[model samples]
Target chain A: MKPFTQHSGIAAALLVDNIDTDQIIPSREMKRVSKLGLGEGLFAGWRYVYDGAERAGENAEFVLNDPVFRNATILLGGANFGCGSSREHAVWALADFGIRAVIASSFGRIFRNNCARNGLLAVELAAEHVDRIAAQGAEPVDIDLEACRLTLGDGTTIDFDVPPADRDMLIRGLDYIDFALRYADDIDAFVTRDRRSRPWAHLRASES
Target chain B: MARTLFDKIWDRHVVRQLDDQSLLVYVDRVFLHERTGSVALTALEEEGRRVRNPQHVFATMDHILDTFPGRGDRTLVPGGEAFVKTMRRTANDVGIRLFDIHDGRHGITHLISAEQGITVPGLVVACPDSHTCTLGALGAIGWGIGTSDCEHVLATETLRAVKPGQLRVTFDGALGPGVTAKDMIVHLIARYTAAGARGFAMEYAGPAVEALDMDARFTLCNMAVEFSAFTGLIAPDATTLEYVRGRPYAPQGPDFEQAERNWSELRSDDDAEFDLEYRIDCSDIQPTVTWGTSPEHAVGIDGRVPDPETAGDHDAGRAMQLALDYMGLEPGQPLKTLPIDGAFIGSCTNARLSDLRAAAGILRGRRVARGVRAICTPGSQVVKQTAEAEGIDEVFLAAGFEWREPGCSLCFNAGGEGFAPEERVISSTNRNFRGRQGPRVRTHLASPAMVAAAAVSGAIADSREFAETGTNGQDAA
Candidate 1:
């Protein structure tokens, strides 16, 4: 994971509600066992036009495909963005496509967690603030994880909310497993107590 | 202080508080499937981590596996073989149990977890699939996670997480005949919107919920994620206990009695308070179906397509218009008698033995209408064998529906087999997202019996009509 302290880049607005993971990267495009090379498949359903199963050409109508926003690194989205599927490939695809942060009114719970783990900043702002940011069009926006602020090209600043733990993880690129492992003794103690209380819940090798 | 069922389970699993908002919660079970399991396991191996409790971890080869008879490693989805091979090898190397394709226990991860009794009351279950919430129907705390979380659970058996707010959705009154659990959930999503339960854990309660059987409860809880809930669950009752007793992974004899005693205590206190509450009258629910891409675009079978002009606000109206364009539907068009090209009855949402029985009841002595391609894939090998023993497969076959092998077939086009492009399909699957079935394909989510009704009529028709008057004017029962 790459640490994300601050980033300044063009922001493309896709203001459609319920932009699910399937639209981010369709199940058909996730044909590989590894996570690499997913950028090419990001929004394949909308980014490219298919002529009978083959990618014939790009769909110029899509916001990200528009020439002016071709290099966007921040995404402005509608409410409940990334609303379906727990597939992390959706986040990976966005990161691979050069998106460093996403500003939305809300997000799917699991998708937000995936973004935290992967160092992709997911900032939840008011819907009006998101609309204001999207109104900036092909202008560059600034995201400061440490300050919890987004600055538009016109110098208008908007505050956003990222959970404290998620902000810490993104800023430091911390592996959550490392943090959880620090409390190994605590986990062991709980397991021991739980085993004594609910033996049926713990499955032994033979019983399993 | 009275505590809700979620608080009870969550507090019991807490190892330590990481922050004011987050805790290190112990996970009791971890289930995985080939599609995402291989990636997680491979990452763990690369990181030189071993599964802390391999015995509690289970894997299956359901996702991306072909559902055709005599299916093997080869799949229509390009590069799908690598996922299957890697999952088998990695799970074996990790020393965790793997329900490979030939294994009688092989099935969709969520169904197999309950079928094998891996998900019991008050346990914390984690999986890489969103439908992992389906296990919550058994009184467990189950939620979907990303691959990184999977690796974390495998390495430490604990997750660092924030406790979500609780929402109690009570369905009172008795559900009318032919109105199944699937309808109850779809109605909730449509009324409340897809993101209604965001950042909250939901509990299904009240009289109507208690009246549902264990299988029906599973159907109700399966779409919790569609409502954008962290997870959803029901209190353990006699139905849940009877379903778990004597399962392969359930406790035996005296241990079972002890387990039952504990499960009996797994309900919300009488004075428990939730962050939010919704009380719905079950009588108001009808056999619901999605008319557009998102599950939120659903309406009762007798309802008409919503016109974008009246769809509220500018953004909402634009989204509706786009959905209508993609689905090729008119604003005022009625959902009934809308012709369809295909019908599917499979996926974790409604592919259990009871689901198969419900569909077969409608298909017996009836044939699919001409030009309609119908197919049925059981949820698991166990479901398939059990349905065959009950002679339900013959009903589907005689109705011109293809009775295929058990797997998550045609659910999301991951298997490379789906309705043709631009084809409209009435399916029992949970999602109706754009191109979810195939390129440019349109899907409408419904119950198993509803899908059967559509297949017979070659159009979107009410299953209750058939339920009231038998398919051939004789008693369907």
Candidate 2:
């Protein structure tokens, strides 16, 4: 859950989309404020269930039960990777599930911000690059945030390019809006200057 | 350029403009929730800063309230009753208005604001909740903020902000039979892929939008967030005025006349400027269902799962794979072939009385699918009580669906009675994001009647079958 520029770990691909907060960590499993193991709930439904319409036995026949990606890291995900309510649990669960970074084609705005603000390396790659990394079949891949590259097995390194702003925010471990607001002093001074220059520009506050 | 209502409102509200796209825009009305208010109040306390104006702030307790009765004395739920208690105390402690459960006004923050008439035309409102955009249906520009932003707004009645590009979605063709505003917007989301509306304020206009009733308009604007829009808006029209009249918060008598006169002109002028524009043929839109985790992964009810081989775009192939894994559907599979385990007919998006009435109308003589659990929750205490009084609850009860109290209920899974891991639910709530209803609870977002129809047929029923029965308002318009 640390947001440092230099950290590398095993990559366990979630390889799914729409991993909502509730599924990321069910409300029942989220009482303690402590950042505990949320990986178990990452795909609890798919990894452990099978029945007529409903998954049988919390641990039944399901795709996640395949037992290969049990502790994999670096999830290779689908588009709109996290869409729904603005709950941060989805990021927490993914990070806890041993995913150091997520390589997705695109990420939900809120989910992406939540991940960065809370310290999750969301790697946005073009679809073909993601497909190549995902095509590496159950093998571990390496992600280097500093070098902005993801290395798969077979000694192949696929470099990733991120926007400088996002890269700075990630490397510095700062929230985008939070970082912007930290300059409130300068912002306030500029506002005062602008108001002085254009008196008619000033407007009243919303009604009392 | 002539100022839009937004410009007029913004001009009146710009306390100042700061650098980095942050303007000290004045907040006309501020709505507070338990979590954000705690942060706001805590900051003011740490700084020993007293509020400049408490009367302008309104607080509600819906954020963490318990929606399920069986969750063990309600005390078992996390911060359930305490949030309610804290909201009241926080409001009182900070000299703000509080809407508690017993006040008969406890519900979604946006619902309370609109119903209270505290949200009005040409106002800039901000809450710590996203659905705050719901008020835009009334022509006010309501935006959601973070807790820190909430602190700023509460302390100074102003928020740093940036104006957004505007997009217009005009629609032609009368709505097809069985098409709800929910369907139309889902079609919009499916077509635009959620982020298409990014960096813009969406203005929903045209014959299709104008034809929509107020409740439908609210449903359309309420979901503007799902499409990545900063805010969704509709100009205040006669329909908007009519919906506002006689509400507890709307003006009365002489004041009402002035308000109506002002509201009548809230539409965009013929030469009004917009950065982008699009159109939708409402009649071409159909009952939609999502096949993947994202709201954008949707197809018309009659549509089938997309085959990745034919998917020309690389992202499309990944979407196809994701749909296959998450939704458990094969390529080219029909959505209706899949079975549904539960049905939900409530959420801030579609739980109004009119929404309930439509669900009731569709379920009048039909029984829910055997082994399928269906629950219908009203958006507010008033809606629940009134629906029962009007026998709408009787219709749901007769159909064997659980009639629950007012709250987010199964939609948010906060009630603890949400989707079992791996269970599929057909819901009328917005957004089908993974695990939204419950853990592993694959959710299919649909209109109320579509949910009811699914409940009746035990699967995705051809809405046309029931829609053909002449039961709903399909033919009336």
Candidate 3:
């Protein structure tokens, strides 16, 4: 579980908000249990043709159809980005699309966390700021996780403040599991104490 | 500053306060879905442990498995089969009950929770999936959790957490013609800038909530996640109790009568604390549709896209740009003119019987677009059976749309049966994120009826045209 902040090779930008789990890789793509390469199917319709035109045309109507943004690294999106069902597929799709960071005005908490834990950055920007980045399409909006700044093509750098906890996550590239894993010793001690104090979990553990 | 149900529930859920800034909250139930649940189960295995309270955790196969086109897991699409298999094995290994693909009780998480009374008010519920907030419609504190979070909760039955401030969105007056809770919420998301419910537990209140039926109330709470709310809820009113009556796990008979008395006391006091409050008149809302990639990038069905020239700021300019490119709409163009390639009616959000009826009424005599792939999928298995029995399925099929089985079909992208990339789809499910369906499959969520209208016209069309097809759109109101 690599943290989203560590990855810089992939930059993802999406047009829609509230991207639910059903939409990410779709239930069809989850046939295998392993976390394999789901990137090819990332934004499948948009990256491909509109109803089978082969490669997306330059004048194609959809964002994924735009030629200039063929390999966009960062995703600039509208408000309530990643809204809807809690599907890690939404995050998987982004990460698979080579989109390491998704700079949006807002994110659905569940989808955003899945991205962070899966090494996909769900960077937050003010709606106003996100609008600017979206306007700069295919021009690459640099997200400096350390500095918490979103730099535009015109050299306009917008400061983004990362929450301390999330910042720690990015800096160390630790998802919640990895973050908790850091306190494995402490957790072990607590588990030992808790087992003795309550025994419900351990008792249940023994029986099940 | 009127108190909403969310603040009331949040205050009561607080248990021991730790020295560190976290709250040691108590969880009543934990729902484990297949995708992330498998990981959580494996982690527990690595730790040599079990679910803290197996009785409190419920497992279901909703996301990964394909139940669409009907029951046989073997017949399920490849992806759906794999998801179900992974989920089934994980749940069995953990001694958790699994609602495998064919189970009559199988469906979206929220619907199952309600049907089973697992979402009784005044309890804390967490699931690995986002729409878990749909249970919040019952006044429970519900939100989505990650696999590790699920793992922690499994071992400890509690997790370190911060509480959310409450946002009370009070809509007074009755909803008008063609507007259901889905439309009202979509309109609000469009108006409130999508992030309006951020950092808050959105409580739907006032005359609007009280007037809404159980299904409508569920629709409101279901989308709270759309606006970044931890969850949303309405107080357990007579309507709530009525909906839960006789549910499998609901308090029965005398127990139920007594439970109602307790439930009635769950409302917040008039002076309850709240972080924010917004008021709207129900009459002011209209049929809403997205002209761009984001849900917030929406306007009334008749409204035009926001002109970049008129965009208020630099950020607004960017939003306009992406919306224009992704939705294939020019700035200031009327979204109503944009064509659609498909229309889907299903998902946890709007896949109920009422949604189907509404959509069916509109499609009865209409012809689906020539090349559009239109389908109507019920949210639950029960809904499918009921709609079919009522001839609603016929209405849709007659309109040239596919009347699929119970599972979530185009609602999300689960079965991989969605429109081609850049092919616009009018969906009844929540969320329309980029590549949400079939990679570049573009989605516009509306009431089932609205999607039905789009299916007929092959573009974003209003459901009003179908008011006379089956029944009056305003008659329900």
Candidate 4:
């Protein structure tokens, strides 16, 4: 995982609210045995037209199909991005497609957590700020994680909020599991205490 | 200090606090399905980490299982059978319970969890599927997690999590006839768009919610994922106790009595404060259905499809227009007049015995409309057997509906058994997204009874009127 510092890239605007993970990558494209090569499945349903069991051509109207935004590294999404399904494949698709940062008004809980684990920068901004960014018409935008601010091409700066822990992990490029392991002793102590307090809740070894 | 139901459960499960931010909360149970569970289980094995508590975990082959009669390990989705086989092998190697295709307990993860009493009140349940919140209807702290998080929970039996801010949605007036819990949730989502409950732990309270049966409560909480809430719950009461009593895995004898005592105190206190609150008169909520892609794009059954010009914001208006184009619908058109090419009646969202019974009642002496293809997939093998014993399957089959095996059949078009591209469908499933059932297929989300009505009429007909007046002379709403 690379520590996210700053990036400037053309933004691809997706103005539809409640863009769920299923729409990001439909279930039909999730039949793979491995997590690799899922970029082809990113927005599979919306990305192409099916001509009787074969790919006919790309849907030219989709934002991703726009040649100008083809290499977009930043995504300007509507409210409630990554709203459904816990498939980390959604993030895998975005990262595989070179989208390092996704700015939205809000995000689904598990999707945001998955983004953190997968080293994807999920930036939550106010809806109006997002609207302004999307209206820039493919202008390059800059994001500075250390500063926690997004700079529009119009010389306007808007501060964003990131939880302190999430911010620290991003800057340091730490895996959440490794970070969580630092508190293993705390987890052990709590479990031992809970086993005593709620004896009935914990199944005995023989129960299995 | 009095606490909310979720607060009580959260406090009980806290193993230790990580800091002022999050707690290492003990996960009481974890359920897995073939779709994503194989990844986590295989990862745990490859990483050489044995499941910390094998007894607390369970796996099932539901998502990719073929619902066709006499089907075995084969599936239509490419590599789906491999997923099933891998899950079976991994679950066996780990010594955790595996509900294979032949297992009588085999069913959708959420439904089987509740049916077997694995999702009892005051417990914390985790699964790798988003609709895991469906179990919250039993007063459990159930929510979804990704594969990586699922692996962590398998290795540690706990998750790092912050306490979600609480939001309470209360419904007062009585729900009119033919208006099921499905209608209530669809209405709620339309009122508060998909992100209305974002980041909050939601509690559905008030007289109407309390009056719902256990199965109906499951229907209500199943769509919490659509609301983007961390989870949605209803405090356990005597109704819940009765539903769980005598189940295969529920506590018995003195243990049951002890559990009951604890669950009785699982209600929010009168003075409990919420970060947000909403109130709805249930009577105002009619038999509702979505006319577009998002669940929030819904209206009453008698209402017309919305016009984009009235969508308030420009972006919203554009989105609405796009949805109308995708759905092939026109503004101001009555939903009842919109014909469907097929009908589906199964999913984790609404495939229980009650849902089956409702659909059967509508199809008892009726026939599916000509040129309309309809299928009924039971939620589980147990539900399938029970419905058969009660002659519900016969009723559906006689009415020209295909009575298939239990699994997530056509809810998602992952399996090959789905409507053709551009075919419009009225489904009892939760999501109605574009290509959700098939490429370019339009889906109208509705309850099982309403789906049956649509199948019989070949259009989006309201079940309320169909029930009051028989289907004999019914035109549209």
Candidate 2 per-residue lDDT over residues B1-477, each given as its tens digit = 765555555665666555555466666678886544654565566667676557667887554565553332253345455444556666788877777665677666777778777777766788866667777888888776645456666666566555767887887778887787888888998887766676478888878777777778778888887887768888888777777777765556766676666566677777878788888877679888877766777888988887767766656566557656776778878888579999998877898877887777778988898989999878877777777888888889899998876666677665445677677888988867656676557888888878888899999876767843322223322
Alpha-carbon RMSD of each model? 2.1, 5.7, 5.8, 3.0
List where candidate 4 sits over 4 angstroms from the true fold.
Answer: A205-207, B468-477
- Model 1 bad stretches (over 4 Å): B467-477
DockQ of every predicted complex: 0.81, 0.15, 0.25, 0.59
lDDT, model 2: 0.69
Best by TM-score: 1
Model 1 per-residue lDDT tens digits across residues B80-151? 999999999999998999999999988888999999998988899999989988988999998899888999
lDDT of 1 at A174: 88
| Candidate number that wins on DockQ, 2 or 4 | 4
Candidate ordering by TM-score (highest first): 1, 4, 3, 2
Chain B TM, per prediction? 0.97, 0.93, 0.93, 0.97
Tens digit of lDDT per residue, candidate 3, span A1-208? 5544433332335544444445455554555555557776555444445435244433365455456665666777755566665656567666676666777777767767566556666777766676666666556566677777767777898887655555666667653544344444554555566445333223233222
Each model's C-alpha lDDT?
0.89, 0.69, 0.68, 0.85
> Model 2, DockQ value?
0.15
The most accurate candidate by DockQ is: 1
User: Is model 1 an incorrect, acceptable, medium or high docking prediction?
Assistant: high
Residue B185 shift from truth in candidate 4, angstroms: 0.5
Could you give candidate 3's per-residue lDDT for residues B33-53 as a string of tens digits? 766787678767876866766
